[model samples]
Target: MTAGRTLFVTWYDSNHRSIIPVGRLVHHGGAEGDLFEFRYIQGALEAMERGFQPFIAFPDLCKVYRSSSLFPFFANRVMPTTRPDYLAYLEVLGLDPTEADSVDILARSGGRRETDRIEVVPAPVKDETGGYTTRFLLRGVRYIPGAEDRIARLRFGERLFWMLDAQNESNPSAVALRSADKCLLGYIPDYLVTDIAKLLEHHVSMNVFAEKVNLPPAPLHHRVLCRLEARWPDGFLPFQGEQFQPVGPLTAPPTHADHALQ
Candidate 1:
């Protein structure tokens, strides 16, 4: 990933039982200095109509927030290097502290906590190979009966397949991950459900496997890591739907504004 990367910020509306891509936090690197900015998107507007309130730190949805470093709200989510087990923390996420930046770490670990319903996801970038790859630590593990036991048997690099659960009341597009023996583990992250389904529908060549598995003592979200890669279909852009579009600029002139990222 480049220094100039954007991470999508999502808020879960528990009442609506939906996840909204409300804003984007962008990092821009330049010869002079690095800059970071956060701005609400059109989805925020819709979310507000659905009873969502702007976060206290970002009270005005229209005002663009610029900072020389990651905002405290997000920066706090990253593990501090001072911690003795900081490297071990990254290890559980299958990341090297030397290689993963705050943005990279947040993207993979999701920056999710019991405190709030916020999540940060890295946008999938196309590679020179005309393909793209991304990893998502599986969610809803505890909810699935026997999932914890099944995950214990998951071997690194073991193949996994997507199984659709159309009858699911919460999300009809819900897809579950399973082993060859059909040990139902968990569902895909809500954010990637639609995009993954589209990929499967087109019959794209995909490689899905167990990237890592950390047992108890690890948070539920970090329990299972999955790596998925697929050949890039022509003109494919993940999360390009209307909801993901920005209503405000990703990086403005350090002033109030409403413009989209280039």
Candidate 2:
């Protein structure tokens, strides 16, 4: 469904050592209640060519799967509400358990597990201002200057900003996040760089805020949660390229593959 609640299924390509968005999972809400569908995108084909085996649950490369309930594979990723630390976990993610559903939790927490390379990444939603807004954990925190101390000092809802690092030796298009006085925080995830750069090149009104900062002992990737808001430039579509499309029609490509991390 073409709703704002879309999330991309990203797979960390072990062979290539890079992240690839392999599918689209959309929540199509209606009077009938929750309806969800998942379809492999072009990235899935790319992953297969690069040696990524399909998951045990969804083995087909081109079949469209639908369910009235959240698929078990993803449902299992969220911590159960019955867990003793569930509430505190939500607090760490800056979510209200009363209002946050499974999808919401997955979006903020990234549905990450050490056993798997899969991750759930929320797609940017178009806001009322005709722009888009999304939230993500600040990446590369361990490499930032005084990162933990600066993150510890950040208050709730603190406004953060970014500057283009055209000189970055690793990635010329890297977007560096910083505070008001301009101390480096970290960069947005690499998967988002091109789209973010487009918004900047087109002069979109960009604003980033510190939604929550999980200081110390927390993993570096989860050190800070920031929200970015920007106008969607005309003719701009994120994640709609050929690489995001299926290589062929939905003909059901081997739906019974064994789960292999290799």
Best-fitting candidate, scored by lDDT = 1
Cα error of candidate 2 at position 68, Å: 1.6
Error of 2 at 229 (Å): 1.3
The C-alpha RMSD of each candidate to the native structure, in angstroms, is 3.6, 5.0
lDDT of 1 by residue, 1-262 (tens): 1266888889898886778889889887665555778878888888888877888878887777777678888888888888998888999999977778888888888888898889999887777687868889997888889889889988999999988889887788887888888888887788887688777767887777899999988988789999888987776788878887767545434422322332
The candidate 2 region of ten consecutive residues with least summed lDDT is: 253-262
- Checking candidate 1 for backbone clashes, the offending pairs are none
Note the Cα lDDT for every prediction shown.
0.81, 0.79
After superposing candidate 1, which stretches have Cα over 4 Å from the reference? Answer: 1-3, 248-262
Top candidate when judged by TM-score against the true structure: 1
- How high is the lDDT of residue 262 in model 1? 22
lDDT of 1 at 200: 73
Per-residue CA lDDT of model 2 for 1-262, tens digit only, reads 2243778888887665567888887776655466667778888877888777877887887667777678888899999999998998888888988899999999888899999888988877677887788888998788776877787899989999888888886667778898887788898876677678777678888899999989766678778888888878888887666766764575532222321221
- Worst 10-residue lDDT window for candidate 1 reads 253-262
Cα TM-score per model: 0.90, 0.85
